[model samples]
Target: MSRSTLRRALRAGALCLTATTAAAVIPAAADAKVGVSTKRLNIQTGSRVTVKGHVDAPGVAKLQVQRRGRWVTLDRDRTNRSGRFVLRKRIRGAMSSRARLRLSTGETRLLGRMNVYRSALASWYGPGLFGNKLGCGGTLQAGSVGVANKSLPCGTKVTFRHNGRVLRVPVIDRGPYVGGREYDLTAATAHKLGFSGHGPIQVTK
Candidate 1:
């Protein structure tokens, strides 16, 4: 073979080797960035849940929840030596709220919905009951959010959805002892659902 031809082949081989090395390095660089996720994509209200994930380096992660379209801090903690963190807490308040694990690196991992329910005959009560003490606790008010059922244990979480709106409220009271009605929602819940006096709504166990 000619010397010039041999030299040309050597140059092409060197270029191919350099290209392969660059491609390999790209992924390694990307992996060095922070990433996070929750152990369970969906969680039930009032249940202890954990958000576990890795940071680019050992550091803190801020757990936040979305309420009224704003992100509010739920908790904060640091990662372990392995650059991984697990934040465990009993989640309460609005169950339909969105949540996420956010790192200082500006990376975030969203947690999915916890409760998904079935359809039921739902009715709302409030006007005349306002200022009255609830059967379970707290007073019945226009802004109260909850459901009343005949058999379900008090404080049991029930998911409801109507007219594109969703709510996961506890069984704070009993009844709708009136037949054909499976659940009774408070004024607030009904309003959020765009429900009138009565109608069919979704319910989750």
Candidate 2:
């Protein structure tokens, strides 16, 4: 081949190599400044909670939650055209929760805390229906704190503390068999609280 043609080919090859190297380096330099931001976190037991926030990076690859010493991946999403990310997750039990964001360049982390409490409203069921289906999909027991409510969704378990005693009961039927009261405690629950013959006791739902 002619020397001019050979020299021209060499120049084109060098230009291509330099362009590829610059392309790779530019993204890495941009990623060094990317990071995540946490906005809000509120967690509860037997309920759903939302986590919201944003990410600042040239490009984000993954988002997740770290709880109980484990990691749960949040859905992969992009920041707005303005470069921000928002995400959420549901907490189920008592544990430490944290947020993690992965960017093409690096990673960002945030921390949060939560507490789980027993259901606030627990009552009792009556006799004769001891073997019947409790609203919570379980068999009813007289001594158990099984409540009957027309409004509360069936299968919901209510929890309450009485005179230093704590009780967790499933909701079942619906009424205060005799009086126009809100709940009807079984003979057993009444006996446990020293109020077998008394009326509705104060309950927390």
Candidate 3:
């Protein structure tokens, strides 16, 4: 063969080999991506839930949880080089939930659900605290049914049934510290519920 023709053929063969190698490497890289998994399928409301799972990647990534169309971002970390990711978050409402992880180059999605129940006890706060800054970044009103929780977020709204009456209260302040009470009722709330004294009630979110 002429020298020019031989050189041209060699160049074509090299190009073909490079293309073949790339085709094989692409799928293998994708297959090496990480993923997440969970042991529990259902979670309960008014209670803390832990999401346990692992990923399947070479390094760490960011994890997240989605519930009722709301997204909660998880912390960033590395996977066990085996590409496993395990994480957890609290169940704040009575709705279905899902999770996803953003790794170095890809993402993994998982599905889950939460089951909420009525509160066994309920309460509220206001009055002498009117115009006071609430944990929810709003002014407190004596006429409004708002409670305070030490741990629950500031703007959480909980509904409960008492004396055949149903009421929903926004969480505002902090605590009762009186007894092992699950909730502390404001004076106005107590009167509205027709309960002169703190009593048992049912609550839900």
Candidate 4:
């Protein structure tokens, strides 16, 4: 080839080699060692949850929670000299799934089972008490979504699941007040779950 053609070919070859090297180096950087953990697997709403984790290197880490089909920022912190981080946050909203902890380096970790969900035998009530004052404070209505528990503190959230349906409600009333019944779901809650009568159910507190 001519001198100019040879020079051009050499430049193109050099650029291709450089690109190949970068592609290999990029993946190595992405294979970072990072991990995270939570203080508890299950907790109540408005309670503080502690998150602790470590990265392979010291950097800023971000905490996020999955809500309404999206990931939202919960908190952020800088790792210590040992690449360890501690973040404490009060969970105020309803999150049905685990929270995510991600590092600036692209390594991510999951904090699974972050809230209370349980199984129980549950029945629903509403018509008789509709418009009547609940034991907690609110007036029961057809649209009210909640559960009645004999011992669980009022305002505690309860999630119900049956027949492939799910409903997250609050402990707004007292109880079913009958033997063998663990929870009494509000009319709206039962309707949402396509439940009609009593049966084996899942109730998360």
Candidate 5:
């Protein structure tokens, strides 16, 4: 081959080698070890949830929440000298699901659930409703503990807070069917939270 042709071929070979070596050196994303301030974060609407955590390595941390079965990044923070970060998100609507943190290396660390609650009026029921078939397939007995909502998916666990008492129950039946009321708490659930006739209650979706 001519000198120029030989030189071009040599350069092409060198470029191909470099690309292959670079590809070989690339590392796969790994699962990161991280610690957050809380495992289960509970907040009411108009309030914000603050997440403070430390990763094993210094990198960008993203706070992810689930929406429509997909993970959506809502906030992010850069690691400090100690690999610690703080992320915040204000609650606008009711949301309760598993949250996670993703690092810059694509490493993901499962944090915990973030429950956002909204205010609603709820009343207790049970007396005449016992032995009724629940919408989710079960019997609503006097001792059965659950909540009733007009639209929440069946078997959806709900966290309720009232009078400084908190209770977690599943959505087992249809709603109170009363206007201006959003929840119909079972007698057992209401009793557990010290709830009576039903006034203001906080519920997480």
Candidate 6:
């Protein structure tokens, strides 16, 4: 081959190698998820929590909470070498916001639900009432799980939390009929949540 032809072939080979190296070094999507410190929260103003998670690509990411029906950005942080980042925020009031991590690639990954609840007074029932008909139709058995509310329609579902335990049950009956109480928990519902006697418990819609 001629000298000039040989030089041209060498230049083409160098260009192909550079292109391949550049393609191999291109960055990938973070493909990460957002996580919260807690799954359930009883807000008391000034309550704070840590939001954290990792990504495949280590970089800055936006931490956000769903508020007023829209995603609002709360803060931002750069991930460590492991692509992990942690951010802390004080909760202002009751919220049903879900947490998510927004990476620089514009991809958002859902972490978990941070359900906030309101406090309400509750009482348990079931002693001699097992054979009676439930307001929602079925017979109230000893193991039947549900709650009774004055205004909530029969069969309405209610979520209750007590002593770090959570329970979800439907309104299978009517109520305590007495004033100053919001819910009357069936014996089984109360037991599942570790709730006993009469007191305040966390409730969510």
Output the number of the TM-score-best candidate: 5
lDDT of 1 by residue, 1-205 (tens): 9999999999999999999998987854343355556565344456666667778666688777777789987668888888887777676533555678777767677766544344578788999889998878888988888888888899987777677676678999888877899888888888887889787776665
Tens-place lDDT digits, model 4, residues 1-205: 8999999999999999999998987854445577665455454556776787778787888877776688777788999988888877776654456678888777777776456444578888988779999989979989998888999888886667677766677888887877889988888988899888987785554
- Per-candidate TM equals 0.48, 0.36, 0.39, 0.50, 0.73, 0.64
lDDT of candidate model 3 versus the reference: 0.60
Cand. 4 TM to true fold: 0.50
Q: How far is candidate 5 from the true structure (C-alpha RMSD, Å)?
A: 5.2
Return the top candidate by lDDT: 5
Arrange candidates, best TM-score first: 5, 6, 4, 1, 3, 2
Clashing pairs for model 6 are none
- Please give the lDDT score for candidate 6: 0.76
Off by over 4 Å in 4: 1-97, 101-117
Candidate 2 residue-wise lDDT, 1-205, digit = tens = 9999999999999999999998987853333444444444333455444444554444654555765578667556566766765555555553334555555555655444332333333344466777876544666665565667666776665553456554556566665445455565555655666555444454544
- lDDT per prediction? 0.74, 0.55, 0.60, 0.77, 0.86, 0.76
Report the CA-based lDDT of candidate 4 relative to the real structure. Answer: 0.77
List the lowest-lDDT window of 10 residues for candidate 4. 36-45
Regions of candidate 6 where Cα sits further than 4 Å from its true position: 1-46, 56-84, 95-98, 106-108, 153-156
Residue 51, candidate 5: C-alpha displacement in angstroms: 0.7
Candidate 6: deviation at residue 170, Å? 2.8
Angstrom error of the Cα, residue 95, model 2: value is 2.9
In the range 1-205, model 5's lDDT, one tens digit per residue, is 8999999999999999999999999997666678886443688877887788888788899989877899999789999998899888887888887888888988787766788888889999999978989888889899999998888898888889887887889999998888999899999999999999968888886
- Candidate 3: Cα lDDT at 167: 58
| Per-candidate RMSD, Å | 13.5, 11.0, 10.0, 10.1, 5.2, 5.4
lDDT of 2 at 30: 39
